[model samples]
Target: MTSGYLWLKAIHLVFVASWFAALFYLPRIFVNLATVPADSHAERERLLLMGRKLYRFGNLLMLIGLALGLWLWLGWGAGRFAGTGWLHAKLLLVVGAIGYQHVCRAHLRRFERLENTRTHRWFRVFNEVTVLLFAAIVILAVVKPF
Candidate 1:
């Protein structure tokens, strides 16, 4: 039973890693594309496509991870999350990460109206913040800080 629990935990971590990878990259991708002259047709097309793909990939992966995360929380995560200060802190970090993702999605929707520089900066900050937030999550999970 413990082995099975570990297995589920592994799956949960895999998806969580995937979500973070996409989160970290998507904004950087935007940053690079921002330098392209907005009037360039080919460049704009490429960027639009990239934005769409980011929109698709980031949301889908996180959603899957979120679902699996909740499943794990209910099913296999109690060992970590069971009524401890560390667990509560980790859960709060998770919520912060997810909330930031939603904020990114909302910002992504306004991609067209905003200048590229602004978008790059905004999403870059978003990514950076999430990285720190997730680092805290990982620390709390692993260190089990009381």
Candidate 2:
């Protein structure tokens, strides 16, 4: 790989890591929000504020990371990997990660409206989904096992 490709990959990896950090923490916030006493208005409001900010930041990171990844693929000749099954699987996992973020947004909106019915345990499980997705994505990217 060229030096330029290596630099782009490094930057993309940084943003992707930041993005995944948000994904990993946002649901933990949800878990806390779910457990907040119904009468603790201040606590709920604080958690909601944090969630909103994190979601917005995460969205920005995801966009930058994805754009950089696309450039690396299309502009830096990584597109040659397009013929491989591993690339296809990796792309599918990327889509799933994006979908998972949206689902987190939906849950956040519900919490904002005070309509969330899910338990803390549910959010705990939801948080693990991102971890699983991250592990699979990394394995596919590195191992490229078909």
TM-score top scorer: 2
Where does model 2 exceed 4 Å of error? none
- 47-95, model 2: which lDDT tens digit per residue? 9999999999999999999999999998999999999999999999999
lDDT of 1 by residue, 50-79 (tens): 867876787788888778777777877575
The whole-model C-alpha lDDT of candidate 1 against the native structure comes to: 0.73
Record all residue pairs in model 1 with backbone atoms less than 3 Å apart, i.e. clashing: none
Task: Give TM-scores for every candidate, taking all chains together and pairing residue i with residue i.
Answer: 0.83, 0.98
> For model 2, what is the alpha-carbon lDDT of residue 75?
94
Give Cα-based local distance difference scores for all models: 0.73, 0.95
What residue runs in model 1 are displaced by over 4 Å at the alpha carbon?
77-80, 114-123
Error at 50, model 2, angstroms:
0.3
TM-score of candidate 2 against the unseen true structure: 0.98
Range of the 10 consecutive residues with the lowest summed lDDT in candidate 2: 1-10
